[model samples]
Target: MWSLTMRASTSVAPPGAKTTMTLIWRLGNSWALRGAAPATSRATAAAIRRFIPIIPLPVDGVGRPSLRFIGRNAFQKGPSTVSETENVFRPATPRPAHEGNGMPQSGRTDGPKDPYLLASLHRGLEVLDCFGARNSWSLADLSTHLGESKATIFRVLHTLEQFGYLAKDAATGRYAPGLGLHALGAAAVRHEQLRWQALPPLQDLAESTGETVHVGILHDGVVVTVQIVDGTRAVRMHSAVGKRSPAHASALGKVLMAYLPDGEVDAVIAAQGMARFTERTLTTPGGLREALHRARLDGYAQDEEEIEAGLRCLAAPITDHSGRPTAALAISAPASRMDPARVAALVPQVKATALRISRMLGSPSMAAA
Candidate 1:
């Protein structure tokens, strides 16, 4: 329902004269006008004073961005605009619970280490986690799951919707997982297993080869080194775990990228743009695709100073029980020792070790391309 109220002070007025009017307006559950008044004539003033409408205020409320988005100089042309919205609406995208020290809702109740900050954000994530079991849920459903109120759930859902973690289906009035959820899920799943299993193999490789060895998994178009086993020898490569190396510059990365479905591999190369790392790194996707093809056929891949000036690496795909490569295991040493003959000597050993680890992990022969 809608209502309009006009209030004016009594004044001397002729029959045909105008007057000033003050209007208060409201819609269902919302107040649109507070106290807007217009100046007019004397007779009109009396008429306006008599024109008061005794009506009920609107009953429904309109949604608005919280104070998080408000600013005094909202449209200013100076530094005042810098404060802007400050990410309160979407709060910094939450890292997965598995990341850092953040606890999953299913786990601890001790809360974040920096408990004073991001507490509300942790609560919001708990709400998102509730959506994991069901495909879609309404505010009431979320409230029931999390023991929160409909209003609270709605606010969190609205904020999440704005942030792209959840999307509301206007037709059904339910919220479903958004693309960001899918991306995070994919990233989590892809890293969850391959990385853990690769650790033992990398350690063994470093022990056997007396050189630095690493296990890298492909993600977002790059081979991110998630595990590294440093060489025991004093004259060994110095690199850290979790460092991201280019697919083209890395023998293991190229082989891992190569094993992806052709179209998927092309999509990755297109997105990452095969820029050169070293003169020996494959600089073109077509060239890489060919290299991948050869790696698939040869059962091993090599980087001959492709990543760094004095480094060479021999890599073999770690096959699943299905015999398809899920990841690549590589041994990296100085070019002085990992020359053509040395790589040739190590290739079979690398392949054999990778096969042993693959079998231990229960991967089928189908992992081979």
Candidate 2:
């Protein structure tokens, strides 16, 4: 949306320079800004001419305003008021000629591939992307973050809420993902097949070991918990299906990273710094490298109070048909319950369960490495 402000010159106008400015806001997905400035002296007119902006200045990202400088001759001055119509819908970042059909990248590369793509749709999806950084957002916060007007954000929120993609809390005036989004998200997960394939074995392992079990995959240098079977014990690790944790601190993450090509481990370390969750958490790249080496040699990884002060874990890699370590299975228990003997016993169970899942995925040779 667009709003116009006037800084009138104290000098008198050409009798007709007295004009009113109108707010150009969002109407559905489109914007129509109607503006009129007074016809004044060349100096005064030039001073105020900048009030008419050409584009909605979205900060190359979340929110937006308008700040395009027009040439001095772009305005047409009538005897009374200066009138202009500015279009706010514009494409995103410019790309080389070959990168796109030029209809504008939807910002969401995985979204629909329709040729007649709508700018408003891309903007709506960008709103969704912001949630990745934080769980909930207020309308004002989103407007400030995205640099768009509250009116524009409200329309987008209203539309998203109508579709059940976003839920609003009447008490807090903040928005979070709704059940409809959850259903769509579950349907859209790339790990759906992996979760189903690993669930049975994971459940069996949890029952056999009386410890919590989790199957997680690496995403953006973080471990995303995909499948979980709570341990039968009264005091087991608490986890959820979509929880994410730092990679280098978790056994599941370390075991999976152990199978990556030589430099990728360092690359991940460089991209995502290994934050120390506990005193035992690996902080240096060298320490993590050695740990990963041991994970590779032993066919499993261990987390001895690395992720949590009193929780220990052992994880083994689950391979795909190509024998690629696509995921990892881990067993977790309280530190007091998992000493050397207990951990040694659980290691084999976790490995066997992971291997069973690997076999289910048609891994030809997920042999001990």
Candidate 3:
């Protein structure tokens, strides 16, 4: 029920000069340390250690600090009445049900003490934890499961609904996990599957073509590289996993955009304007549309120094079981090594690798079609 705020400020002098850090802990109207000395750069840890001892913390018989909240009455007595509240400060005897371990009945470590922890936030999470085994929950159901009052559970549910973490049925007043949770779970699953399936082919493609290979997915109109295999060539193009690139200018992005619906592609272009990265970058809508048309027809996409000067890339789409382009696999190389003849030769190899990955994902092939 109490609110606590903490802020830290650091002052750095010129190179080789001493740095000073000030930690401010505010509890409502009171400051825990009014004019504590600024901690030097080297002695910050020592300063914190010095401050912790004066905190009047309760330690167990073994000499370790025991952090447990008694009640609001304990805080009301203040620091001067420490001796009188010694019994209140001692760790509460664990319930009979959780006797083996020192942990509470919930099997969770008593997290931070009450003053620093938000009871409401913890209750809200407890409500969410209940939904793991079921599709939906009513207020009474969550209240009983968490052993919290119905009114408290209702407030938590309402807050979760407002944040799109839960959706409430208008007719039944029941709550279920929302689209936000589904989106997060789906993204995690898709990324894991894509990386697992793409790694082998990516490594093979890199070794065969002697060029850097990447597996990327479109997220929020950007190409997020999920996996990468560096080429054997000493001067090959370099890129790292988890790097994000403009979806409009990269081959991996273009291949993904090519397979997506026209409306979605337009939405991406509208949201992330076609910022030119090089002279060859397609900045106009009509030009990009034409390029996508070519990519769709040729079953692959090409980037000729569009994203970065002196670099060339070719990419093909990896489809999911539903036949949707879930990710793209691409090969990148220096322009000198990826001349027109070399690119033409590599195109089929990239497309083949992509098709193999798509089949692994359970997408039907042209022969089946």
Candidate 4:
């Protein structure tokens, strides 16, 4: 229910002209009166104030105006120069939660009522949601999907492109998911409990072997390093956390690839070609298949200067509860420090650390194996 209050005042136009009366109307708590004239006669204004009536009206819809009071007593015997009018409606109150179909009672699903829900942001997320199986979207296609104007959709697309969440083609003007989104996905994958649980053991391994240790997971045919423990050696290998390397060239990558299904392995290899990083890097399909077979048989993989010259990496698979290789633990060192004999000695230690991590993940098959 809404209540209306009316105020009256008299103003003189000229010496010989008649008096003018101004009526100021205010609606409910949401609106206020503006441009009201000053009282000319206190007694007459008081009399007018006494007869002012507060009318109650029903609020039917959002931003809907109430009925105007047009009764006989709405105007009094006065002059005709009631100039200047200002009527501004306040923002309407949201209806009760139960009144709308599946509308949240709190005006928000996640938190308390927030009047300033940015529509542009909501629409931008909706635009991102349109890029699932299709992979790319044009302005017209996004506008059609979202039922928004082309101008609005263009602005949203440009903003997303600027932030690197979406990439736009210069010639085609189509947009796809960008590298920034993949970075965010990689960060999320690292945030899993396994990374934290493996930190202590990885650190211990690095200290024991005096070589850099890494924990990485497969993402989009690449191995993304989630955790890194630098070795105590002065000339140790240095790799950033979130660094990505080819699955066929790095030991961590090969171990992870070896455990995936045959079809998935073929797809990953197809998507990420076997680019030869070094002379020792496997470039042919048959060579990579043989290496993966050896990794599966030995429960570990080796990178003999495959990714980078003068560097070697040995990796063992860390399995999940389903015995799936969700991550790999690797130790990296200079070729001079990790010679064939040293690698052979450290292989058992790397496998033991990996098995401990798999056990921590509650892998029944790993426990049996």
Candidate 5:
């Protein structure tokens, strides 16, 4: 599974500068060979070329600043060398999907070991994985968690921080997911089918109800806003996509969680604790259990200022082909305008539009549910 190719280039050595051999090693979809031997002697250059095993390779590929690390570390210049660096293998810009949507997204090193896998890359990815379970990680926390030496973890974290995949605080030195990761996540979400199918209907719902609409999906036990449509009303929920919110505090989260089996529901609850956001927010498992049961039975979920004092939300599940709820369609409005009577009127509309979106997703069981 491994191959070696080598090439060299020639450049003029200035006065008192030692003759140098510039060698470039590239991997992935494209490769290059740049540098030259001392042009002082053609015979010497020919001798070097004969000894070198690498030749110029044909190039064909686009490139970007990929963060995956491979090759040798920076070395100090020796007596005979003016300046030199070891091989740096730069892969193609568009990384393969299995590596994780251009972020090379996964960092689990626990699986079956691959000899070719870079331990540093694996460790860095694992660091990224910790962020999903929680927001920030300190170097000590990661070092203890990974059972890696402090020096190794420090190097891994430093490398990732330099690449923009992880951000480190100046005073605290606590690390968090950076903008680079968010950008990659956005790129991946833009290609997801669920958001694509739900967009039109969600827009329509926002227009009809004159309320802000959100399409939320369950991620790591919390509700994440995937798509948002602004309402026509001047006073509306000013929301952004990709926001993570508590499951017990929002109708969107409750509706999405209702369809899960008890075991998975427990997992979600375990991962995302029931933190009370407002007086009405469900803090006890028993109360949230009841709410989820009500959601499954009624085909919808409601948040009566549970998450925010003046905002109310109603949500219905959007099922996939297997009839499992893959996402939730929800609308948020000011509580003053969403009285019991208006809620009753809006319930049918919310459920119907969610059903429509589910149908578009090839949900065979929406009618039966």
Candidate 6:
């Protein structure tokens, strides 16, 4: 694998200016991040904003590129040379893949070409991508999405399973992602802007209500906490950052999902199979839709013991500069303390903090600078 690392440096002294950020892109073998340096500043880094995967091209004409690079193969296979395994370990300048039509052009290969190997690896990545937001998967779904043969996908799955990158559900015969993959993903997101930006609001909400405050983002059709602030109370609540909850079950999740277009919301619900978490939980798709409708009308969402047996929550969406709510801020506490009157009182403060963070992110709001 080729490693491309770009480091930004302040060229010269500009009055009252500082090196605002540094982006570190470390390419690793086996498709993962190995290590990283300390954070300098969040403002200047470009790569940290998002780590877009470098598109992998195949040696054979399997994957195709778009019109902009119509003839360019996403993967380039170099000339095969007779070398020992030890000799093959050395790095060489990688050539771009061949492109003819809008597809990767393959040459007549009697054996496995380097490009084909890389392309196969990339396809395997695509298969891995399919298992996001869920813990398990079925073979048929993986095959259908990747357009790869079941046998090939099974082989890849077996390898990933062995490597602890994937897990097989014994009861359902479905394959879901493993913990190791999640660890890597968690590491990546820790470097993300949204994660860092969420911390202050989370802390503020927690301090204000003396309850657990969570900052969740929509992922894989559900709302998941990207950051959390534990409460000050002795019996304070605790939640893991990556814990997944139904969009309709948690105040945070529903309010964030409510901001999405109706079609998107319906699609997510359809795919996830809206199940009631409690008697108070939204039991039907229609009911969930109505809840979302209410949330939009009131600019907030409420979960009255919808998920946990004795928990109550209130949430407000956090928007970007364009006013698109990509995340939500929520405070959750035991129902005994977070009664309807208390929850109602906290709504304005939660909304204010959300708006504060939104304004910090350049969100267009009455509170924005």
Cα TM-score per model: 0.55, 0.51, 0.61, 0.53, 0.52, 0.51
Q: How close is candidate 4 to the true structure, as a TM-score?
A: 0.53
Worst 10 residues of 3 by lDDT: 16-25
Off by over 4 Å in 5: 1-191, 367-369
Per-residue error at 84 for model 4, in Å? 51
What's the CA RMSD of model 5 in angstroms?
A: 16.5
For model 1, residues 145-222, the per-residue Cα lDDT tens digits are 565578887888999899889999989899999988998897577566666776777677778889887766677878
Q: After superposition, how far is residue 222 of candidate 6 from its true place, in Å?
A: 1.3
lDDT of 5 at 297: 99
Which stretches in model 4 have alpha-carbon errors above 4 Å? 1-191
In angstroms, give how far residue 147 of model 1 lies from its true place.
10
- List the pairs of residues colliding in candidate 6: 57-74, 57-75, 71-99, 76-97, 136-176, 137-175, 321-363
Off by over 4 Å in 6: 1-191, 366-369
lDDT of 1 at 88: 19
For each candidate, what is the lDDT?
0.66, 0.74, 0.75, 0.74, 0.74, 0.67
Give a tens-digit lDDT track for model 2, residues 1-369: 233332323444343233333333233323233333446688865554454333212222211212232333332221122223233223333333433443333244333246787879877987888777778999997776666689999999999999999999999999999888898886455368788878898889888888999999998888999999999999999899999988899998899899998788878898899888889999998899999999999999989899889998889999887788889999988999999998887777888888899888778886443
> Residue-wise lDDT of candidate 3 within 27-103, one digit each (tens)?
45332421224456757757655544223443333322334455556555344334554654555423333244432
Task: Give the higher-lDDT candidate: 2 or 3.
Answer: 3
Superposed Cα RMSD, model 6: 20.5
Deviation from native of the Cα of residue 17 in model 1, angstroms: 60
Pitting candidate 3 against candidate 6, the one with the higher TM-score is 3
lDDT of candidate 5 over 265-355, digit per residue (tens): 8998888888888888899999999999999999999999998999999999988777888889888999998999999999999999899
- What lDDT score goes with residue 331 in model 4? 95
Q: After superposing candidate 1, which stretches have Cα over 4 Å from the reference?
A: 1-126, 130-138, 141-193, 321-323, 366-369
- RMSD of each candidate? 18.2, 18.9, 13.3, 18.8, 16.5, 20.5
TM-score of 3: 0.61
Evaluate model 3: give its lDDT.
Answer: 0.75
